[model samples]
Target: MSEGPLYPPPGAPTPEEPAAGPPAQPAHPAYPAPGTTPPPAGWAPYPGAAGGPRPGLALGAAHKPGAFALRPLGLGDMYDGAFRIIRFNPKATVGAAVLVTAAAMVLPLLVTAVLSFTVGLALDESGEIETSASTSEVLAFLAAYGSLLLSLVLAQIGITLVTGMIVHVTRAAAVGRRLSLGEAWAATRGNRWRLIGLVTFLYVAFVVVLVVYVLLWVLVVALADGPWPVVVWGLVSVPAYLALTCWMWVRVYYLAVPALMIESAGVFGAIGRGWVLTRRAFWRTFGIALLTVVIANVAGSMLGFPFSLVGQLATVFTPEYALLALVLTQAVVSVVQNAFTAPFTGAVASMQYLDLRMRKEAYDVELLREAGIISE
Candidate 1:
């Protein structure tokens, strides 16, 4: 009977394949009703043998086809790429950072100490301290502090230049080119002092803004010592201070360094450029910068902690030896810390700049063209 029914089974459809043709649909059926549509031929609920979502078509998204594509970067890319750039060319990225950092730090300290001692000795020998203790001592103190300030400014300038070098080197490496320290310097050659000037200008601008805010508060207090002063402080000073600080540091100047280094922008140009680049992407850029700073600090602490502990321990037993050891250890740790951290910061900045350009200006296209990956 079953063998005979095998031929008679054409009368009704099985559960696996529904019967075709139009029919009255069921209100509450266990299966899809008659005339119900099926997926088109060669189609699927999901693509591929593994039944995963279709490539490029799933979720209305497209895949990036290559590495180092000039595209809007993800937070992970911004982060991981920071270390990737360092890994790509450690000699250039880390070496340049270490050397420049050492110079920037040690030179200033040396100059400040030597000049202070010299000024103190000269004042002592001239007997100027005895007659006019106030005047001579003030002069000596001013000279020492002035020298210190000068050295600090010089050190900052060196750091600015080093930042430029790091950007150039990391950027080059990102696009598959390794650079030497000299080559990285050359990439930012004519713009070294310009970068420094841009940084200094920004610093001055921030200070000016702070001073203006302070003066406004002072003026408000001088005009009214009562509730009016309290009202102004609450309504104007506090909110304005917070808003302007966030706007300037986080939104305005966050990308200025990269703009100056990568685009050869002037001081004011860099500020404007950074403002433009950070538009509508404040949180992402802020997150990137914040994460970079945290990572850098953590890494620096990790590197320096051992040396610091050893130095402190040694000092309890042998002071003179510990002093020498501590100096050497700190210098070594500083170099190591900067070597890793500087490139990461530089890479983060460069990545942010590139991502901004890619989003705003199709900068990846230009980069690809420059790298000969694409035709004009």
Candidate 2:
């Protein structure tokens, strides 16, 4: 060889080296460090992966595709995906929420106004301004309160119905599709009755719990020898009852709406499915549901705070129009808040439901197949 020696003396340039040339470059500088084995081709980090993804600057190579960015998400994926869906299909998702919110809000207010006017007329006619009010007056007051409660319940039902439509639209969006308002409504047609029935069941369950608690208090009042015993009984029973009620509600109905809407299950079937799916994942489901609600409430409160403050301030400066301003402010705030929150919440809940399906049934495989990422 034409080298100074077989190899140059320690650190000296060999015949293969170009003396005084530009610095040498690696063919693949991005390769793993010296003495380390490179990861297998196409390997990447994944949720619940074995030892996690190989350390590298490359993006996830093994993150299989789906309708959404990635299918079968982990907790964070589902949480983040909820908001993503909102952006993905705002018209169907947010528009539907806005429309439902408007109806749910305005109709209730109108009913309250008409009912209040009628009640006021009745009271004025009774001419009971002097002395104590009559039994009919007391009954009228109760009726007013009852109507208010009914309006609230109706509003809740409307929200729940809209939530079902939102889940429907989101599922379509997840499959690389969109739904028109009519299409979403049409999709929910088969499930509307089941949806109402499921909500009714939950309400009935809650009423039953309340009635049972009331009966227990009545018994305590009748049987207890002293006020101390009754007070003690109330103290012990109330918290326990409330805790049990909350736990039962979370476990039984966390997935009920999704099951009814997505799986097309019946009311009782949805309840049973929710119970089964939540059997081992109760806390996870509950945490997600609770987190969604808390976030929505916090966001809504933040958005409405300024408007509410304005309404309150206007009461002092413009007393004549304060009531109108407050009412309109509340309506506008509620509508805007619901528009954002309802769809986002529904999307989050539906993702949680999808997560359960993936964990329990490998639903991701089908999603991937539908997205053409896999065959058979």
Candidate 3:
């Protein structure tokens, strides 16, 4: 029987020519053939066949596309990248984050409850706001709040550092093998101190950069001998200054932590290794890191827009609805803010340093081989 619509009763165009067989090619005259196996991954070319290899037969080896495109990295890009990584490793990323989030939320409430009880006791003893909760009370509240906030920030930083190391180690593990929950915990545990020191160094570096920038601003303002021309020159140089600062940090620290962790080196040694590895490819390194940021931001916006839309929709109803809308709006904003930032942060952690190692150290091949995805 004819193959229905596809065959059209015997001989139609046979639905796009029944897939062409390999084309015929006359041999090239006076071509010198290559001797020996001609090395791996360089070139093999098409084998010489009367009619070259069948058109349907796939050629050579399949290859992955190059690194994500180079674009300027931004805050938004990091969040977008984080979410993409989250999607890929939902169990490790979202699952662990949810548990961590719950802990963060509950711990604060618990502290608040205890502090409220303590405040109640103070009120009972003193029996007057002015007397009981005077300067001491005010100062106590300020101290408590300040400590709480600082501790929260540091805890989050620690969590971020640990989470990042876990994610990378997990991803690399996944390429060739699977990791149990216990195994992930163990890998992170093994790497914890190194990761913490790495995180600490980065944190300090960021602060130092800020301090330097502030100092420059002060210098610029003070050195401005009372005219628009000096101010204009100073303003014009801000971009250059910012770029130089960024370049310096990336040059000094880009792959340092990874090298430190992988090689177990000292801080200065790690910095030197990173510099050497990233030496010749500053722009490419910058571009890939930047592109990762761009991709991440786009992804985060795509994710966050929905929550923000729902929030905006709540505003259309009434004044009472407005209060509810306000709460909803803030909640959505908080979530979207976090979502937007998390991805690129993760991406930066993953890609920039990894790219440096690959380019400089041939670590990518070692990585691929270690994962058993490639052999030599």
lDDT of candidates 1 onward, in order: 0.59, 0.63, 0.47
Q: Which tens-of-lDDT digit does each residue in 1-376 have in candidate 1?
A: 0000010011223223224444322211133237744432211111011122223322211122122434688878777666655654565677776766566556434543454345432233322334544665466555544544564465456556778877765555444444545556656756777787777787888999889988887777778858866685778668878777777886777788887777667778888899998989887778778888898889888987887787666555654233234444555666667777777787788888888888998866655433334443
> Per-residue CA lDDT of candidate 3, range 268-314, in tens?
77678778877887886776666665765776677767777776565
Name the top lDDT candidate. Answer: 2
- lDDT for 11 in candidate 3 is 16
TM-score of each candidate? Answer: 0.65, 0.71, 0.57
Per-residue lDDT tens digits of candidate 2, residues 1-376?
A: 1101011112223234324534222211144557745644322211111222223212342233322443556667776667656755566677876776666556445643554455441322222322455665466555544544564566667778888888776665454444556656656776787798888889889899899999989998999898999889978998999788868877887779988887667888888888888888877777778887898999989988898888777656754343344455666677778778888888888877777777788776655444344444
Off by over 4 Å in 1: 1-67, 108-152, 217-239, 310-336
TM-score of predicted structure 3 = 0.57
Regions more than 4 Å wrong, model 2:
1-72, 108-151
How high is the lDDT of residue 272 in model 2? 86
